[model samples]
Target: MKQQLVFATNNPHKVAEIQQQLGDRYAFLSLQDIGCTAEIPETGRTLEENARLKARYVVDHHGRDCFSEDTGLEVYALEGAPGVDTAHYAGPQRNAKENNDKLLSALGDRKDRLACFRTVICLVQNGQEYFFEGKCDGRIATYPTGDGGFGYDPVFIPDEGNGRSFSQMSTEEKIAISHRSRAMVQLEAHLKKQSDVARPTA
Candidate 1:
């Protein structure tokens, strides 16, 4: 039987991406699946803090083993101005196009386009918390491209993507080298170790 785990998110798309990454090693549940309707607060100053806040909320309120992740597109030129505020970078509305536009405008003709996508995942199990982090180094494009991804995907090109933005690639291609995928890999390894420890030695 697969170990059941709760992922602190209501978006089925996000859950699906993770399921694809982790395979059938575990049965993943979303916030809706666990009947959690409360909007978990993410009032943290950093990616790790935000992830921890969400994961801790689930453990405290729902009493479940849950995990949450926070991702940010940090640009070297911008000095990571929107690290924790990646979602609402443009305004309180959290408009993706506006945010991308703001990013591009701020970067206006700057020679340095170096950036990286970072993801921090916080896992709360049995009342204990653990963190896993991953980063994908890349650079921002001069203009937005592609129509397949959301947020900064259209303007960010991975170092290994052969000059193509994430939005230009298929879902499988993006996840294969995404920051979230790297973090998930670590989380899966940790869980596997714990499972092995819990298994009976016949």
Candidate 2:
């Protein structure tokens, strides 16, 4: 039997990406699936804190194994202006286009375009907590290009990419090297270790 776990997020894109990356090792549950409709607050000052807050909220409220992740695009030139506020960088509306526009305007012809995407995942199971982090070095584009991805994907180009934005890449290609993907890889390994320890020796 597959172990059941709740992914503490309502974002379809994120849920889909994670589910695709995790495969069949676990049976994933969504907030809607478990009747959790309350808006979870993200009052943390950092990605790790926010991820932990969300995961803890689900585990405490639902009493179930749950995981949450927080991702940010930190631009070196901008002095990491959007590190923890990536979603609401522009305003409280959380509009992706506005956020991207604001980021580009903030850069405003500066030559230093170094940036990185970072993701932190927090998992809470049986009152035990774990964290995994991943980061992808990249540069911010002058303008948004592709329309395939959400958030800063259109304006962010990974260091290992072929000069194309993440939005330009196929989902399979993006998942192969995304910050979230890297974090999920670590999570998979940890879960496997826990499973092995719990298995009965013959």
Whole-model Cα lDDT of every candidate shown, in order: 0.91, 0.92
Best by TM-score: 2
The residue-level lDDT of candidate 1 at 67 comes to: 97
Cα RMSD of all models vs. native, in order, equals 1.2, 1.0
Task: Give the alpha carbon lDDT tens digit for every residue of 60-138 in model 1.
Answer: 8888989999999999889986789998999988898999999999999999999999999999987788999999999
Report clashes for each candidate as comma-separated counts: 0, 0
Model 2 Cα lDDT, one tens digit per residue, 1-202: 8888789988889888878888877878888889999989999999999999999988888888899999999999888979999999999899999999999999999999999999999999778999999999999999999879899999999988899999999888899989999999999999999999999999
| Winning candidate number (lDDT) | 2
Q: For candidate 2, which ten residues in a row score worst on lDDT?
A: 18-27
Candidate 2: stretches off by over 4 Å:
none
List TM-score per model, in order.
0.95, 0.97
